[model samples]
Target: MLDTQGRNEPDTLNSDTPEQDLPALDIPKHERRVQTVIQDLPVETLCGRISRGALILQPEFQRNFVWNSTKASRLIESLLLNIPIPVVYVAEAAGGKQDVVDGQQRLTSISAFVAGTFPGPSGQKRDFKLSGLQVLNELNGKRFSDLDSATQNLILEATLRVIVIKAESHPDVKFEVFERLNLGAEKLNDQELRNCVYRGRYNTLLAQISQYKPFLDIQGLSAPHNRMADRQLILRFFALQRLTHLHYRGNMKQVMNRELEDHRDPSDAALKHLEELFTRSIDMAWAVFGPRAFRRYQPGTATQPDGMWEERLNFALWDTLLYTFSFYQKSDIIPNADRIYEEFLDVMTYDATFAEYVTSTGDKADRVRYRADTWRRRMDAVVGPPRSDSRTFSRKLKKALFEADSSCAICSQQIQTLDDAEVDHIVHYWRGGQTIPENARLTHRYCNRARGGRED
Candidate 1:
């Protein structure tokens, strides 16, 4: 437990902390600044520090774990060889205590190895056979005791280089230090804290819905975290209903709490509402673009940079929703708004074929298409005046053709006629035809040219 300075404040450093009393230590020439391997630090002690209210994983921060156990073991072997290891960072706890910032995995492994907790390969034990001159004893063969004294001495000597950072007064200040130190580094994300807020509330609701007979097969939920971020966005997209500028700082729990408190009681209505929405929207995605195209669009491949899968998926779903809303605006038999939202999620998540299709179109083009379509809609609403320029009319005409379902609006022919299709005004320009949807259609280039339809 953190020893509190006052009843209300937990472990806040006041004026008398050691950081204030001790003069700053200079870096030694031999031990300038390097990570050091420290042995004999008990596993119990380490785990205790981690559990004691330390912000183990900062929100939006993920610990680096690319280095596998082999590298870790090699680090251990280097320590055993009495060679200088790298410098390890240890932050000062509130009352002159310390916590590891970097090298946590190596530290944890050593602790686990000390406690005989590491699963050795091929039924081997957590012991090593060493060959060298005896100092503390030879550290050899399966278990701590098997190591002779010299090896133990080498491990102990390595611990001497550990540089401890004595935290200054105002212990909460450490959080600022932590943030600054990691500002450029990869950080944890908001969705990671779903349980912290909604332990028995919204998250529970989502979990229950997921386990229910119909929802158990949500493959998106089972994907890797990047893909799952896409899943999370799907959930948040519907839950929030506006994606003009979604951010990582928005807490899902707070939103869920607000939504739940508005309800009458603990019921399956909300859960089922979300599931049904995903199912319907996914159906629409399949219907509109074809499932094969959707899969190619799933943005979670290894080739892309880290942490982009979810954002791209979010963008795609938002655009698709815009498309659906626009398409169904004139129809009375439109599916339930809530149901369509959920189906959109399913199309993004479980429908691998749909994911591929979207990926195949490529991310850059999809984004461009979304932006262009949005601009086209805006222009359509604006050009309702008595008159406009030919340039304005021409741009709007091109956009309509681009957004239309078929290349040739009249005969449902493929629009890829390579400069052979011309935008025809439903109302002739000379006949005072306005630049609008009703006045737009696709015609063969030759037909349009022969008709002398160039001027507005």
Candidate 2:
């Protein structure tokens, strides 16, 4: 009902109020409706778009696909059996690219089945045979190619509804609308949203590396994190490596988001190198610290490492400890476990710098830098000073050293190439040796780590 000024009255909810017609909601005319275009595109056309990269079948972030071949095959059978399936929701981005926001499983499975390769138990894509069809029992065990010509046409020509949320519907708005529509569904996190914002191989690497076994074993998990927590941790590792040298400043979340945006599409080699770095560093961390890898240590019990670590994981300590580990190779760190673990425990158990910064204001730039610095300094005191881009010998000095004797000082073997040669401190850095050329000797990267700070 309109009031005296023509303003609509709020609807009354009094239990005693008599039933009456209520005015419809008066939404502002300028408010934009979700501009969407619907198409009943044939399965073949949809698959073609996916293959051509015009339509993205996978969401930008890696989804833990719950559909096994059995589930995927059922989707195919439904298509062939003429059973109606749900519509695929695509968000049309600028440049005419369409990203799948919903129905990823159905579309991805159909495309994979048609292509003859589907994700197997090990994550490798392999050719699959159809199975578990209730009605088409005779069609079970048949590959896509095994189907007769008429059946193949039936599969390809089947129409699937495609709902395109026009590019004008911003990504943020799309997410909010989707969540509002899917009320009671799980909420999305930053990393999950990044998977949509940043579409490329780097995002895939985040998903893949988050499942590294040693890290999971340390965390006491049998599977990858269903939430993107592990992925964020992995991302922080890479982002810090990039930002640390620049003396990073900003909110951690913004830093991570910018990093993802900057390197959305990294080269395969770059991804592989990062994989090795994480694998090697995490393996050494697991070897040295065991289950107590990243938790606060203080208890006196046998259930945890050093009889003192709590069950909770510490994010600050995780990056700080792993940064120290990254300075040395896993091969050398394994043998030095006794010293490294003892030092790490001393820091975790007693050092104020390590304890204070990590427990509170942990994400502060100063705290982050000092926590890592404190661990690195302690580690260097035991293992010796490491090669530094800023503190190391000049290129001229390095050349003179190699020319004087092109042999590894530690291994006492001929150095094959300049790329494989690294200058070592004759008197360990912690033992008061200067980074001067007189104290430096060229050695292979492998030999230097294996030497483990011992005097020649």
lDDT of 2 by residue, 406-441 (tens): 988777899888878888878665345667877888
How well is each residue in 143-198 modelled by candidate 1, as lDDT tens digits?
Answer: 54455676545554455234454443222232323334444544323332222222
Question: What are the clashing pairs of model 2?
Answer: 61-195, 298-308, 299-308
- Model number with the top TM-score: 2
Model 1 root mean square deviation, Cα atoms: 21.8
Question: How many residue pairs clash in each candidate at the backbone level?
Answer: 56, 3
Model 2, which residues run further than 4 Å from truth?
A: 1-38, 51-83, 91-99, 112-157, 165-193, 204-229, 238-255, 266-291, 298-307, 319-392, 398-423, 428-433, 442-456
Model 2: lDDT of residue 306? 49
Cα lDDT computed for each candidate against the true fold: 0.40, 0.70
